[model samples]
Target chain A: MAHDTTIQTAGHDEHHHESPVVFGFWVYLMTDCIIFGTLFATFAVLRNQFNGGPNGHQLFEIGGLALETALLLISSITYGFGMIAAHKNEINKVIVWLGITFLLGLGFVGLEVKEFIGLIHEGAGPDRSAFLSAFFTLVSTHGLHVSFGLLWILTLMVQLAGTKTIPERMMSKLTCLSLFWHFLDIVWICVFTYVYLASMI
Target chain B: MSEHNTTSSGESHGSVSSYIIGFVLAVILTVLSFAIVVTHSLSPSATILTLSLLAIIQVVVHLHYFLHMGGHSEHRWNNICFVFTIGFVSIVIIGTLFVMNNAAVQMMSR
Candidate 1:
């Protein structure tokens, strides 16, 4: 009976000590989804209420949106490679893949910023039309997440400069960052479809 | 160390060729979406519908190949939860938009 109690306690301890990183990241994703979800709902309501200005059909550029999608999609793949390298304990490969991912992500942001500047220059700024407002909010919200993700990756890279791969702290950070990066990708897909594709109509 | 081994083994579960295939498919889908939009082969509504469908497909491709989201494990529950959350959000978005649009239209008419 004493032995049995010891075994049970050990099992409990094991479960308790399991990495909370993934679980915490999952919670974060849920919350982020809700945030974007609210934005999506707002966009849906205001999409057609252009208030006598340009609508999606007039404002959206499908070609540019496609390029943005490619950039994000490729970045996601690079992130996958980073994960693979992480699993293999190839620190250099991990860093390289992450660098690629970062660069691609930066490219995505650059294009989006350019697009926004062009829109503002042409008087299609968010304040010009309700559709533009909704569009900016939905798309920029995703962009903000990507920006945050980039910052997170940079922080992780610095932290990992001298840390071992399997250390609990580093692994936790990596797991959380992975969830964040992937979550952004998922959100972009929705944005691309509903905002860009639908707007083209 | 044990966790590292488990993750490393997970890598072996999927073949490298699969990743390449997924990447190729994604690129093809993206290009196709561009072609449809540029050619103006469809009406506005039709274009929206088709392109959105394609975008959804591309998303699935990324989720499956890149993220490795679906598999039997404790993590499967996480995926289900994620899906449910997204579904709930979609409902809220569509429903709210419908109600608000009707209200706005009524207000404008009056």
Candidate 2:
């Protein structure tokens, strides 16, 4: 009976600690949602205001966008696997999954930047039209988030080197970073479908 | 449902199969969306509407399988807050675009 009481008390204490981290991560997600919200609104307002320049239908290439979308969406799934590995206390597996995710994210960004350069070569830069301006803003905002997430994952890898699995400090940071990473994936889905696929139509 | 929060520390939890399923669905949706665009079967407005719906579904998949959102937690308020944010943003985007687009058309005609 004494052991049972101690176990119950310990469980309660862990709950008390976990709730704050979960709630804090949720708050961060809300703020990030707001940022994406603003970008979506900006895109909506400027989508058709091309100022006599090439519009979405003329510029977007569905083949290239498909590749970019695949990279980002797959990365999100890889990150989920990383979290699962972390939960199991498999430190090496966690690091490997995260490394894969980071590389996939970098690949997505590389494709996006290359696409932008291709557009410039075709004389369809952001300054050429209001539509291009909105396109660059919405897409680049997501790319910037991916870049930051990569940096955060690198930092966490270093911190996790000496830390035990499910350590409170590391869990908090991972929880937040996980939310951010998944959020970017969600944003990319929107961009791929609306900006790329719809434009091609 | 239990009052005790079961912290499965160092114990593997969450189904791996779900992540794989979500990833597959995402790829299928992307391919289907691109197929529609490449074929150009729909008009611009229709294409935009359809694609946006697909995007929303993809977002839901990522949220559920990847983020593991939506469950009984002490922080139900967080989910409620996120829903409200999405709603508010939708209104702002749609409403502003509608009003501004009309105003612009009117000014151009004048």
Best by DockQ: 2
Candidate 1: tens digits of C-alpha lDDT, residues A1-201: 222332332231232232656777787788788889899888877777777887777777886887888898888777766765564456777778888888899999999999999999989999997888888988888888899888877776776666555465665677667768877887887787777766664
Residues forming the 10-long window of minimal summed lDDT in candidate 2 chain A = A1-10
Q: After superposition, how far is residue B34 of candidate 1 from its true place, in Å?
A: 2.3
TM-score of chain A of each: 0.88, 0.87
Worst 10 residues of 1 chain B by lDDT: B1-10
Alpha-carbon DockQ of candidate 2: 0.47
Q: TM for chain B in all models?
A: 0.78, 0.76
Per-prediction TM-score, please? 0.84, 0.87
Q: Rate the local accuracy (lDDT) of all candidates.
A: 0.72, 0.76
Candidate 2: where are CA atoms >4 Å away? A1-17, A162-166, B1-13
